[model samples]
Target chain A: QKEVEQDPGPLSVPEGAIVSLNCTYSNSAFQYFMWYRQYSRKGPELLMYTYSSGNKEDGRFTAQVDKSSKYISLFIRDSQPSDSATYLCAMTQRRAGTASKLTFGTGTRLQVTL
Target chain B: NAGVTQTPKFRVLKTGQSMTLLCAQDMNHEYMYWYRQDPGMGLRLIHYSVGEGTTAKGEVPDGYNVSRLKKQNFLLGLESAAPSQTSVYFCASSYLAGGPFGRGTGELFFGEGSRLTVL
Candidate 1:
């Protein structure tokens, strides 16, 4: 089984709608979850990050992690056309001195239309 | 700062040809990584460096090799390319600050990808 799985959604929604993106993982050791946004021809930028199981909010974006369920989510409120991008979910386990390695999901493409 | 920058934004390589992709970061970060994004496969790690003069294999490292001779640069080399190696390659860097609680080691700053087509 793939370590991390996410729906490759070309999910389209109207402007002002709420958008939710999610991912599930098989590794319970993963302690950090992150969301990255990538626009066409651009690199993936860090959107939101969370440690362990909890929720972190940043403006219109919210990231939630449930370690028990091995699930994580990113919620976007009042979506706009500018919000159209591929959202990638990534997870990492905390290790000593060495930096953690990341495992990424098949990005979900989101389109917020006018 | 340019953050992380990748060279040769696009390239076409004939099968068995060798090429090197360069990634330079001005952030002085200790950790650098190379990942390839394929259609439906997401971004899979090719190789990574924890510090200068150090390299480690990642999930997909078979057709690729990497080197980190400088703290600010990491290079991924394709020794004899294959059609299966065609993908968008990205390089990222992150710093270790205040242990692991403040932010992830993978709080990556990415570069504009290098798209390689191995024909």
Candidate 2:
């Protein structure tokens, strides 16, 4: 099984709708969770990041992590056409004296239409 | 600053032909990584360097080699290109891990990307 699993969704929604993207993982050691946005022909950029099992809010986006269930989610409120892109979930374990390496999910493609 | 820059934005390679993809970072980060993105495969790490002169293999490292002789540059080499190797390559960099809480989250800054097609 892959370390991280996410629904490869080409999910389309109307503008101003609420969007939720999620991912599940088997590695309990993962402590740092992150969300990344990738547009067509572009590299993925860090969107939101959370440590351990908790929720972090930034602007219109909220990231939630449940360590017990090994599940994480990203919620977008009042979505816009400019927000259309692929969302990927990545996680890594924190190790002292070593650089953390992230393991990413397959990513969910989201499109917001007017 | 140009956080990370990849050379040869696009390239076409014949089977068995060899080429090197260059990645330069102006952030002076200690950790550098190379990843390939393909349909349904998100991003798979090819190789990474924790520091200059040190390289380690990631999930997908076969048919590819890497060198990090300098602190600011990381190079990915395909000794014998294959059709299966065609994909968009990305380079990323980050500061050292494990600082104060939420201080160093290992948030990576990525380059635009290098699209390679193997014929």
Candidate 3:
């Protein structure tokens, strides 16, 4: 099985709706969780980040990590057309004085319509 | 400054052909990475460089090679391109201020991806 699993969602939602994207991983060693948004023809952009389990809020985006279940989520409030993009979930372990490489999930495509 | 830049934004190759993709970073970061995004397969690490003159194979390093001769540059090479190698390639760099920050730690500062198609 893949270490990380996310639904390849082409989820369509009306503008202003709340959107939730999630991923599940089998590796318990993953301590750093992240969410990225990728527009067409561009590289993925970081949206949210969290360490260990719990919730983090930034603007309209919230990231939640549940280490016990190996699950993580990104919540988008008041979604807009600008929020339409491919959402990717990533995880990695902490490495001192070096860059912690990331493992990403198959992105979920989101489309917010007015 | 351009955070990260990749050359030849797009390319198409026939099977058995060879090519190299170049990635340059201006963030003065100590780490650089190459990842391939495939449909439903997600992003798989092909190779990475911790610092100049150091290279490491990642999860999917087969059929690919890499070099990090300069602090700001990393190159990924395909000795013989195959249909399976067709994908969007991305290069990323992370600042050293944080403890080994990955893409999640902050904006990874990715270059516009290189789209490759091998027939």
Candidate 4:
């Protein structure tokens, strides 16, 4: 089984709609959770970061992590056309003084229509 | 700021031909990583470096080699390319992991990406 699993969604939603993207992981050791946004022909950029089991809010985006369930989610409110992109969930166990090995999900594609 | 820059934005290679992808960072980060993205496969780490003169294999390291000769540069080389190796390559850098909360949350800065086609 893949370490992280996400729905490969081409989910189309209208502007001003709320969009929720999620991922599930089997590794209990994963301590850091992240959401990344990738545009066409571009590398993924870090969108949100949270290490705790609650919610973290940044602007219009909210990231939720449920450690017990091994699930993480990113919620976008009042979505805009500019939010159209692939969203990927990534996680890694925190290790001091070393490189953290990150495992990424297949990503969920989202489109916001006008 | 040019956080991370990858060279040869696009290229096509004949099977068995070899080439190297270069990643340079101006952030002076202590960590660097190389990942490849494919349709429905997401991004898989190829190799990574914790500091200059140090290199380590990642989840997908076969048919690839890496070098971190300089603190600001990382190189991923395909000794002999294959069709399966054709993918968009990304290079990223971050501060050392496990810092105090809210700082350097392992947030990675990435380059645009290098698209390689093996025909």
Candidate 5:
């Protein structure tokens, strides 16, 4: 099994709808969880980051991590067409000083239609 | 200010041909990384550097080599290109900073990307 698993969803939603993307991992040592957004022909950009397990809110985006279940999620409120992109879930083993390499999931493609 | 920039946005090469992808970051970050993104495979690390003059192999280092002689640049080289080496290459950098209540943390800033196709 892959270290991280995410559904490669071409999920389409109407404007203003709430969208949820999820990922599951088997590694218990992954402490740093992150969500990245990649537009067509562009590099992945960091959207949300969380340490260990907890919930973090930023604008219309909320990221939740459940360490016990090895699950992580990103929720988008009042989605818009501008939010359409590939959402990638990534995580790394916690270490001191510098950050370690990230293991990523097969990103879920989101299309928020107007 | 260009956060991160990659050279040769697109390239195509035949088998046995060699090429180098260059990455430059002006953020003066201490950590830089090279990754390749492929469909269904997500992003795989090729190599990384913690600081100037230091380099280390990543998860997918085979058929590739890297050098970080300068602080602002990291290069990924394919000595003898293979069809399997074709992918979108990305460069990212991060610096240790105080995050969320004085905690030492960091986040990656990525370049646009370099698409290379090896035939």
Candidate 6:
């Protein structure tokens, strides 16, 4: 099984709707959780980052991590049409001072319509 | 300054052809990585560098080689490309500062990505 699993969603929602995206991981050693937003034909950009567990709020996005459950989530409040994009969840375990290898989910594609 | 820049935004090559994708970062980051994104497969790491003159293989390093002779530059070379190697390639850098240096403590600045197709 893949280390990380996310719903490959083409979930369509109206503007101003609340959108919740989630991913479940199997690796207990994965301590860093991240959410990335990728636009069409563009590189994935970091949207939210959480180390270990707990919730972090930034603007309209909220990222939550549960180490015990090996689950992570990104919540978008008052979603807009411009928010349409693919959201990816990534996890990693550190390796000294080097960059840890990141394991990513297939990504969840969301479409917010006006 | 451009956070991260990748050369040859797009390219096409026949099977068995060779090419090198260049990545340059101006952020003075110590960590750099190369990844390829394919449909449903997500992003797979090709190689990574922690500092100048140091490199390590990643999840998908076979059929590929990398060089980090310069701190600001990381190159991914395909000795002989195959149909399976066609994908969008991205280079990313991270600045790890403060904190306890946890598992995921830094933000990765990524390039625009290079799309290559093996015909």
Which DockQ values do the candidates obtain, in the order shown?
Answer: 0.69, 0.76, 0.70, 0.76, 0.67, 0.64
lDDT per residue as tens, model 5, A13-105:
999999999999999999889999999999889899999999999999999999999999999999999999999999988577765588999
Each prediction's number of clashing residue pairs: 0, 0, 1, 0, 0, 0
Candidate 6's residue-wise lDDT over B1-119, tens digit each? 78899999999999999999999999888889999999899999989988899999999999999999999999999999999999999999886544245434666778999999999
Better of 4 and 5 by DockQ: 4
List runs of model 4 lying over 4 Å from the truth.
B98-104
Flag regions of model 2 displaced more than 4 Å.
B98-102
User: Which scores greater on DockQ, model 3 or model 6?
Assistant: 3
Candidate 5, B1-119: lDDT as tens digits: 99999999999999999999999999888889999999899998989999899999999999999999999999999999999998999999887545443444467889999999999
TM-score of chain A of 1: 0.97
Off by over 4 Å in 6: B97-104
lDDT of 2 at A17: 98
TM-score of each: 0.96, 0.97, 0.95, 0.97, 0.96, 0.95
lDDT of 6: 0.91
Q: List the residue pairs that clash in candidate 6.
A: none
lDDT of 1 by residue, A1-114 (tens): 899999998999999999999999999999889999999989999898888999999999999999999999999999999999999999988675666588999999999999
If both were scored by TM-score, which would come out higher, candidate 1 or candidate 2? 2
Residues A1-114, candidate 3: write the lDDT tens digits. Answer: 999999998999999999999999999988889898999999988888888999999999999999998999999999999999999999987665656588899999999999
What lDDT score goes with residue B96 in model 6? 59
- Candidate 2 CA-lDDT value: 0.93
Sort order, DockQ high to low: 2, 4, 3, 1, 5, 6
Query: Each candidate: what lDDT?
Result: 0.91, 0.93, 0.89, 0.92, 0.92, 0.91
Give the clashing residue pairs of candidate 4, or none: none
Interface DockQ of candidate 1 = 0.69
- Among these predictions, the greatest lDDT belongs to 2
TM-score of chain B of each: 0.94, 0.96, 0.91, 0.94, 0.93, 0.93
Taking all chains together, the TM-score of candidate 4 against the true structure is 0.97
- Candidate 2 residue A87 C-alpha distance from true site, Å: 0.5
